[model samples]
Target: MKASLETLEQHFATVIAANELSHAYLFVGATNSGKMTLAQWIAQRLFCTNVKDGQPCGECAECRRIEEGNNPDYLVIQRATRTIGVDEIRGLKQELSKSGLEGRQRVFVIQDADKMTPAAANSLLKFLEEPASQVVIILTTTRLARILPTIQSRLQIVTLQSPTLATREQAIQQLGVDSTFSHVLSTTQFSLEDIQGWLEQVDAVQLQQTFWRWLTQILARKDSAFTLVQTQILSTFKEQKLQQLLPDLLLAALSDLFTVKFALNRPLNWTNQQENLQQFANQFSTQQVTALLEIVLGLRSMQEANVSFQNVLEYTTLRLLVVLA
Candidate 1:
């Protein structure tokens, strides 16, 4: 669920009323944290002829056009092929200079602005310094440090955080999922639709079977069999899919170890494998579970370092096996 930023919304409306809104705004936040949604809201409010209470009325012709992505004044600059290059920035400059097609301002929403290449960043600097009077540039990125300082300097920063758990639950309920699925979905900061789509594609039964087999093989010190599992995941699942699932799996493994230590409610995600987890959980102390979580976090960093996924899982499994032994 998108957390409404009432303060920011009011600030935006005041800025608009004063005709002093910044030419560029950099929205910094994690993925799916409502940055994009908030940006669109602000754009709609700025362009809407009949705004109310710092929010867009959502009934006017401008709002409808923007909602449908057909507003001539709205320009979205997303990565065309995983990178925003200088060529794209140059073309945007040409477009920004033109008159607004149908509204007060030409809104340029740059999604994943962190993907901008060095050349593109430099090209964007010129526009930021001398932005067109009737142009609004909204840049959204998860990695603010990657953006050039010059670019950051020309923009006001809008920070968005993950929504609260209660809000997330309400959102899940609105999507018509049961309480059990909602509990699992709460582990992430995604919307209900996003979670449902991911779960629909995940084939969790197959993953659980493979994961259980892998864990058993590790306990038995079957390096060859574990290597095969690693290779299979690398070849079959997309990199992003593995990245998402592995974190949840790591968290579940840590929780299982803890539950075994303290005899708490069975570990959340892997509760179905309680018997197997319990066998080792009783053998390990709570400190060991904490240490295991630390190791998993380090492995997560390795994955983010762009190391091959196969290497990460292989190295991670070996380390865990050694620690358990």
Candidate 2:
């Protein structure tokens, strides 16, 4: 069953209240799915001197210090790049060796724990095996498969679920996205964190519209789809951003097309372009749409493997054109 963030928080609070806290916790979920936020919340409760009814008083000095990153008892380890190295883990180990200077409990949160190098992960494993008393270790990762099995076996794993539709809609609205784009985003499997990241991009709406128009043209077998890739898409966005967002936009559009073809009353990513999507959907067989959707979904893994963004876009355009032909 799916649990909301509040439910998970309350469960953790109860665990803390009972003094049944685990030595280590592994939070696994999609990026921006509140893993880090929950980690911080737990940290606040752990450090708070004014805990009441299984919850931390947010106005407490301990809570404020943790929030401001000024708490010596609370340490956060994160890398700016792809991998967290041995030196970083070693530094954390050294810090963990010490006792909490200010707060009653020491809490260490490692963000993107799957990005740790093998040696770094092993170092962490050693530390977890001999964890300090009164210290709480929280590790978070979007890519759970990449974490070492030995380390995974040592911690309590918390898998966060995507929020319910109502919660997601409220979040999207608060992000200042208009009803149209908000409806499109809230319908997808995207988490609140994912929506927030998209909104941070200045060209997010343009990118979505561009991908929609390109898909429509490709289904119509128009040469402008290929032209748009070369002149507009490739030139408009950086390679990294293009590689990330393009596949997602395409997949969402494909889902909308599938829904439109089947006359499903589901929400769509391109809500304002429903008529256009219906027209596009009518031109393709269900099997054809399904096949194209698979192709687009496969692009995500390719992008993860450092495949060329420009080549992927060109190849996708060519493949879709062939499929339509």
Please give the lDDT score for candidate 1.
0.72
Give the per-residue lDDT digits (tens) of candidate 1, residues 1-325: 2235666677778887788887889998765677777778877887787887767899998888888888878888865355788898999999999988764678899998987888999999988998788888999987789899989988988887767766776777566655544555566534455556655666545555566676666645567645765565555455465455665666666666676668775435554566777777766767666767777778766865678777788887787777666
Clashing pairs in 2: none
TM-score of each: 0.75, 0.82
Residue range 1-325, candidate 2, lDDT tens digits: 4365789999998898888999899998765568878988998888788988878898998889888999888888876565799999989998898888864778899988987989999988988998888899999887788899999999988988755666677778898877776766665545565557656765566766666677778888987788888777776556353356567667878888889988888777767878988887888898888888888888877766667887788778888888878
How far is 300's C-alpha from truth in model 1 (Å)? Answer: 3.9
Name the regions of candidate 2 deviating beyond 4 angstroms.
29-33, 79-87, 101-104, 114-123, 142-149, 187-205, 239-243, 262-265
Off by over 4 Å in 1: 1-3, 29-33, 52-55, 79-87, 97-99, 117-123, 142-150, 169-184, 189-193, 212-225, 228-239, 255-278, 285-291
Clashes of 1: 0
